[model samples]
Target: MRFNRGRRSFLLGTAATFVADFVLLVPGLLSGRSVRAAGQPVSADSTVITVDSTVIDVSQGAASGALALVTGTTFNTSGTPEQGVRVRALDPATRNEFARVFSDANGQYSLNLDPGIYEIRANKSGWGAISIAVTAGAGATHIVDFGNGAPPPPPQEGTGLVTGTTFNASGTPEQGVRVRALDPATRNEFARVFSDANGQYSLDLDPGIYEIRANKSGWGATSLGVTVVAGATHTVDFGSGTAPPPPPPQETALLTGTTFNASGALEEAVRVRALDPATRDEFARVFSDANGQYSLDLDPGTYTIRANKPGWGAISMAVTVVAGEIRILDISP
Candidate 1:
């Protein structure tokens, strides 16, 4: 199953306006392809170049081989969809440009390429540029959003920057994981953001001690304590150590049910989630099917089951499952 999780929203201050222009000497394209804009170019040799209104079409080149689709949206520092953002795919080893396109008014773009590993770069005028490595598989569509790497305003007085990456149990960079910085004494969250496609994240906070935690659904969480120093950048990574051994198999219980609306009619597309009461960690989540049915298999334990839909109030109930037993719990309203 494919999941296109939403990117984290950022609250960045306004950026300085500048003029940028550069030339791209792509192998097949015309030599000295100059892109003229009003701002200072971020990188003269950048593999990706942003154009004001002109879009260089390279879809035909990509269509000549086995096809893989790359699609995503582009957002500015203020978390607004940005139009005309240029997205380019290039060969990682040789830095050769493969396909190029510009985002639409909705900040959405798509590119076709041969199945392989490539560096994808996204850039727009007045915003910072970003490049991330991605593996494109034949006939598969991959999502890569350009919402990070925006040059943030200078840090405030006595504040420092915290930056790091999040990895999974296998030590592979994991995207869309939420990272939070909290005050150790009060346990109040100071800042929170999701990692980018490269599994990288950054936070700016005042000089103080904080507990940084990284978490994602269905994954073990890792955290640490760090002291933020004035004018210094601290690096902290999560789940980058050796992978732990697999756990022993345990007996599981089945939970299944149907959902109905307040009017006693079957309801579809309701989100059902089960959470561990002690740690408040989510154990399973699924949406009701067309028949208003949902199911989950979990280890024997007590759980808080909650069901909610967009236009209705949420419903919650507590239940305990027994090993090798099937439990039926229906939800309404």
Candidate 2:
């Protein structure tokens, strides 16, 4: 459903720590001869060496608009990464698809979108389609992953039809009503059709969660959640004259930081991670740029942040964020 609201831009936050240490040893003499140094080498006393530490601090603040990100890998039923799967996100208000992409050779896809809730779907030839719902608040990042963990769904069944009729508040057959059958697990549409003059609609679907809805103009009916069996015609009816209200607007927060190396220089191309404190699932990951600057916009909450680089050590810290606040942190490794 559409709501009257002003559009805003998305914001980003960065993460990093700032701490370093150094240890130096002096050479000693023995038996009036310069003690031969072992294989160990030492820098001149005048030379300064800085060793990066793994401590990070995160602060929070408000954001006007926020940049939202969705990224994850796609795998097959065999538990192997798969490529070329079509990933899609649908805008709730327009019911029109806003973003679509294919998994790369590594079976990964990423998309940047405005703050809102979306219906995500993925499918590939020889694989069963999947769907799920995700809420991407202003300046927030979320990840939705898909895989059977077993074997891919076998070939789809060729039989089964879902039939439905729609009636108006007056108990008369309603024509031109839009009907949709969805898979609740992936929040994906199995089929969509409109009612005929007789207010009858039909869709052939494989057995799964039998969720369906009907909408006409600005009014709609409550969703019917049920289960369907193969080769059966499931009959459900919609007779509501009410429209669901719009969801409340979401608040946003900001997080940002920089990454540095042992020499106290900005380090670029480091992968920074944000995880849900309770589930420990990574929700977002961004890389440092040429200047070692990074940023994120997110819904305020407690999260575990981490930074990773190949040769340097990894760092992890926990922090809480509140709406409309800015937090700055530094990381060294």
Candidate 3:
């Protein structure tokens, strides 16, 4: 209180030094608002997403009670929001996650980002990845509705169509020609058709190697290899042009079997026929000869032998007949 001039000057000088030090460090210790790179205070903004002129009903992952707009999805997760399932602004060019958001239990997320394409990935535990594209613009409210799964993709064009006709080697429309398409390398048939009255056959097939075979009774079968390209027309013509007839006494699967009783006595006057399992259709039938031997002609197919007599029990078994091969179905009671 009674300091001299020199003492008073020292006290004033010390106070000035302390004040200067405090001012220098005040900027660091004080809590200040977030600043932009240009030193401007950051301001809060609302995120908005617009629904485009797309068919929203069938949009990807659109289902019950779900509303879907561009800003991702607004949904109800019940109780609490699933973590990691947040709203984020992605870099349109590189498609990298840039911004993030968390949805409340009512599934509300906001991404106040600039105008660009952003990806919205959900944190749906135990579920597959769910994502959507959002076009965020200034002064827009993006309310995307997400359900438990992904949205359905847009509709596509009709499946490829295959069209054509089957003609006999004589260049005439032969009705009842069963045409089949087989994969060239696998030889597995996937499509079948019948020639119309005009000997026309058509099919829509995926692009692949295929074999078109024209099958008819009495006449030899005709086949041609074809490669179907996508969106390209494949015309197959099995011109009946000058095809010779099968040689006389055309070879067929001729099966011969003897029928007899368990007592070793030959049974005669027996009615026998080959049965097809797939179609349940019966083929040719022949009676037993005097020696109890029976013969029948059939195409290469798995067949069953059925026998009937006035007093004897019927006998039958399955027989697999390969093309140009003979198979015997012995009769047993």
Model 2 lDDT, residue 74, Cα: 77
Residue range 69-150, candidate 1, lDDT tens digits: 6767788767778877887877655667776666767787777666776667776667545555555777667666676433
Candidate 1, which ten residues in sequence have the lowest lDDT sum?
A: 1-10
RMSD of candidate 1 to the truth, in angstroms, is 19.3
Q: Write the per-residue lDDT of candidate 3 for residues 90-201, one digit (tens) a residue.
A: 5533656654445544455444444444555444444223343444444444555444322322211221223444455356655556666665435566555554444444
- Score candidate 2 by TM-score against the native: 0.29
- The local distance difference test score of model 2 is 0.53
The 10 consecutive residues of candidate 2 with the worst lDDT sum are 27-36
Q: Candidate 2 lDDT, tens digit per residue, 1-333?
A: 111112322121232321111112222211110111232211111222223322222111222246466667777767678777776777544657765656667777665556765656667777545544455666655555555332212222443555555677566667667777665334466666555444555554665554465666743433444345565555556653221111111354556667899999878667676788788786555555444655554567888988888997798899888876667778887
Measured by lDDT, the strongest candidate is 1
**Local distance difference test, per candidate?**
0.59, 0.53, 0.44
Per-prediction CA RMSD (Å): 19.3, 30.9, 27.8
For every model in order, what is the number of clashing pairs?
7, 29, 29
